[model samples]
Target chain A: MISSIFSQLFQTLLIVVLAPLLLGWVNQCRAWLQNKRGAGVLQPYRVLHKLFHKDAVLADNASSLFRTAPYIQFACMVLVASIVPMVATDLPFAAAADVIALVGLFALARLFAALAAMDIGTAFGSMGARREMLVASLAEPALLMILFTPALIAHSTSLTTIVEALAHREFVLYPSLAFAAVAFAMVALAENARIPVDNPATHLELTMIHEAMILEYSARHLALIEWASAIKLSNYSAIGIALFLPWGIASAGDWNAVPLALAVLFVKLLLGGAGLALLETLSAKLRIFRAPEFLGTAFLLAVLGMLMLEL
Target chain B: MATFTGQLINFLAALLLLIAFAMLSQRRILSLIHLFAWQGFILALSTTVVAYSTHQPHLYYSAFLTLVLKAFLLPWILHRLIIRLNIKWDVETMINVPTTMLVGIALVIFAFNLAAPISQLADTITRSTLGIAMASVLLSFLMMITRHKAVAQVVGFLAMENGLFFAATSATYGMPMVVELGIALDVLVGTFIFGIFFFQIRETFDSLDIKNLEKLKED
Candidate 1:
């Protein structure tokens, strides 16, 4: 029991610290792909460290919700990090690792951030919140359909069990999972505020969704929110790994296998980050009106996955 | 543990059905959204209790999702939408309240009948409540159909989803984490879209009455 607790604590710490590094890595990759010398891989960590030491600056109209958004966002991401099966499948709180709950964590963060954005009563903030919510609503159903495909095969909603089942190679060629995977990827892209949904790199108000909401925030508050966003990105990647690539996860009651599991996870994160950057680079931001159709396509694909499962 | 869980689920299912009835008979949009929130709270409480009783840790997350989305976030959004759209004073009904209530009762009966066969296949302790859940869903749908206001219709739609979520939890423990997360995202996004729709509706008709939308429907 003590060992499990220790491992969980270590894993949580690892994710919190490594999240910034991963973000920097993605940025560096994106820049390299664009044929420019990017910022150093440790740039995110440096920025975060600097931000934490600075005082927060808030707009005069900012309410309590705005003041509290950073903390809430940080807490939500931390909660999500704890639930994911990062280094080991048999996590201390593996039972709490329901996919739905993790989504709730994301929702919690999004809700606070969006609310904070609107609390300031800025046109851009409300607009961003509106757009964010629109994307979330459509993305969610498709995500649920995708999950049903996997749950049908694993016969349990527990992430640990699902990972173990997949690792054991219980079955092969889940056409439903394949479709769900594509839908999930689309939802993930939108949820994370990536390309074809909203550009992470752009600052234009008309095209901005995530950035516009954060425009009013400054200093430490901005840093925490940014750090949380990085963690969120990593968390989504980890979720993808847990669901689609469950091979390297160490089973519960296997403490001796953790190091190997950690090494495998690092490799997966690297590949996932690179792939995300590449996808972002290849895709142009979709028009605001086209987002629903993009998400609708995801929803259809997800439903297709569910229908395939019945076949 | 099983008995406690079974009783708790039964009580929650009953509460959900009652709320469904309330939503159906409600003439005020504000009250309907409040009742919908109360239903979400009950769903969250029951999910938590079931998670505790069965040692299904993931259900706790499900409960949290319910609390966040149904109880707090969605309601808050609706309230803001109501204020912004300036529809706080008017709530029009397509069907008379008493007639809507009677139709809701009939829908409930139909739901129970439809759910009976499916419930028989479920092995969970809350298996019997699946019928109640399905009934609530149908009644919520009936309420949606009977409401002439856009906001009320959205409330009914959300209520229907609440019933479906309850059924998912009670009949099958809970959905997979990914699906739950996905649905939660959908709900959050859906609310935003609906909020935008409410604005558009008001802009078009200068009122939230869905009767105006009928003009757009071809003969």
Candidate 2:
């Protein structure tokens, strides 16, 4: 039991520390693909350090909720890291929350962040909040529907349970899963503010989505928000790994397998990060009005996946 | 494990159903034709899988005919027609997308319910996918009713034919070779006639939106 707690703490610290490194890797890859000498992979770490040491400058109109939202969001992300079985399947919190609770956690963070964005009463803030809600409303249903497919297959809502069932099953091509996987990839990209949905690097103040929401923050608050976003990305990648490729994560009885599991987790994150960068590099940003149809297709694909499983 | 080929046939039928859903949701005229070709391609491949598994020599011919006529010849004709007619326009839907999709889901459930007894009576390894074929047919019919462009409706009609061919292949195996040939020729001739009618409609109405036909009916 003590070991399990230690493992949980270690996993949490490891992912939080490594999250920005993954971000830096993706940015470097995107730069290389775009034919520019990019910032080094350590760039995000340095930026985080510099921001944390500097003083925070709040908007004059900020409410108390605005001050606490970043901590709430970062805490939510860290909690998600602990709940998801990243490097080991022996987490004490593995069964603490089911997949629905996991989704609720995401919604909780989004609500506070959006509330805080609107708390400032700025046009960009409210506009960005509304846009974020729109994307979240659409993405949330598709995400739950995607989880339903695997949940049905495993007969459980626990993320750990689902991963174990999928990992132990003999590898056979599930056509339903193929459809769901593609739809899940789309939702992940959209939810994470990745390219073709929202450009993470773009600074066109008039049309930015994620950036506009947090435009009021500076220094330590900005650093915490940035770190939280990085953790959110890592959390999503870990969920994807658990659901689709849970092969190498060490099960509870196998303490000796932990190092191997960590190695496998590292390789998977590297590939997932590079692949995301390539996708962001290749696809052009779509028009804002087209987002509904884009997510509509994802919803449809997810529904199709569920139907295929039922059939 | 006892029925590998049977499982593969079911997989292919699922693919066919997915393509049908894609076509129903699609809005671009060019992309609709591409999806139609893909449906035809899947139909031919499923037929070959059925033929090879069941040792039916005539199905090979049906597969070849489908590959040549539907997948290659028909899409080529439609592509040339669109290029020549300068009708590179987005398809207009009569009903909204979400409603159409809901209706489509209802139709799929209804198709499975409708195919239940019929599938039990059939004696093929791929009989289980008959419901999917029926769903594909209903979905294509939905496409026809929803779209406003004449070319899109025509493509919808051809996709319906593809679904029917899939049903024939999945239910009792391929149809008689002569009937298959006759249907193939009829579809080709019908395309030519439709191509001519597009020009007439465009000349008379100045656009390919079939809603103009309602004006004529009222007059």
Candidate 3:
């Protein structure tokens, strides 16, 4: 039992620490693709370290919610890290590894941060909150449908079970999963505030969704929130990997199987990061009004996946 | 091991059904959101109970999700929406209170009948309560259809989700973590979008009455 706890703690720390590095890698790759020297891969770590030592300045009118947002965001991300099958699929807390619960963690964090944004009563904050919700509204159904496909296939909702089922080649050529995959990718892009949903790199008020909301946060609070955001991006990527790839994850009861699992996980993360950067580079941000249509399409695809499964 | 927990699960399931009915009959938007929160609370409790009984850790996460999203986050968003939209007054309902109550009863009966075969198939501890859960879902849907105010409809929508969550917990233990997370994200995002919709409705029609939106249907 003690060894399991230690392993779990170690895995959580690895995810939290490695999350920023992954973000930096994505940024650097994007820069290289754009033919610019770009910020170094270690830049995010430097920025985080620098911010952690600074004092946070709160707005006089800021409510308790604002003060609590950073902690809540960080805590929720940590919770998410704990649930995701990062280093090993045989996590001690794998029983808590329900996809719907994981989505709830993300939602809880988003809700808090959005509330914090609106608490200051700034126009940008409210606007950002509104847009963020818009993106989320359509994304939810699509996500549900995507998850339903896998649940139906495995006849169980547990990620570990599903991963094992897939790794063991329990089923083949599920057309439903393919449709769900596309739909999931769309929802992921929107949920993470990527291009075609909201540009993560831009600061323009008219176009920003995620950035505008955090414009008021600064110092350590900003750093934590930023780090949490990066972790979230990584988490979503890992989620995609677990559902789509599901190979090479070591099952529980084999301590010796961890190293191989870790290596495979690392390779998946790298490929996933590069793929995300390439997708972002190739896509343009959709207009705010058009976002619903994008997510609507995703929802329909997910439904189609479910229908196919039923058939 | 099984019978005692099964009985407790049934009791909690009944409480959840009671809350669903209360939410359906509520006319005030604020109170409806409050009831929705209570419903979420019950869901969380029942989920926790199920988790403990079944030794399923994921159910605990499911309970946590219900607590945070339904009990805390969504209600908070609804409260803010009401305040921002200045919609604290009594909301308009499409159907009369008595008629709605009668319809709700009919829905309950229909739910039991419809869920009978399915519930019989379920060997879970909370199998008998599956009918109540389906009834709650149908009743919440009815509430949505009978409410003429946008806020009321949103509350009903949320309550429906609560019923679905209860079904998952009681009948099947809980959904996958990925699916739960996805639903939680969806609900949070849905609430925010609905909040914005409330604002837009007020701005466009100068009232919170969703009947005004019907004008678009005619056009």
Taking all chains together, the TM-score of candidate 2 against the true structure is 0.95
Worst 10 residues of 2 chain B by lDDT: B1-10
**Model 2 stretches astray by more than 4 angstroms:** B1-3, B116-123, B217-219
The sequence of per-residue lDDT tens digits that candidate 3 reaches over residues A1-311 is: 77777777877888899999998989998999899998988889999999988988889999999989989999998888877776566677868758788777888898998899999999999999988888887788678779878878888787777777767784355656776888889999999888889998999979999999999999999999999998888888877878888887777666898899889998998888888889999988899988886786677557645544432
How close to the true structure is residue B90 of candidate 3, measured as C-alpha lDDT?
89
The DockQ-based CAPRI class assigned to model 3 is: incorrect
Q: Which ten residues in a row have the lowest lDDT in candidate 1 chain A?
A: A302-311
CA lDDT of each prediction against the hidden true structure: 0.81, 0.88, 0.81
Tell me the TM-score of each prediction against the true structure.
0.59, 0.95, 0.59
Off by over 4 Å in 1: B1-219
Judge the docking of candidate 1 as incorrect, acceptable, medium or high.
Answer: incorrect
Per-model DockQ against the true two-chain complex: 0.02, 0.45, 0.01
Instruction: Name the best candidate (by TM-score).
Output: 2
lDDT of 3 by residue, B109-186 (tens): 677777788877887777777777887899899988987888888888988888888777767887899999998999
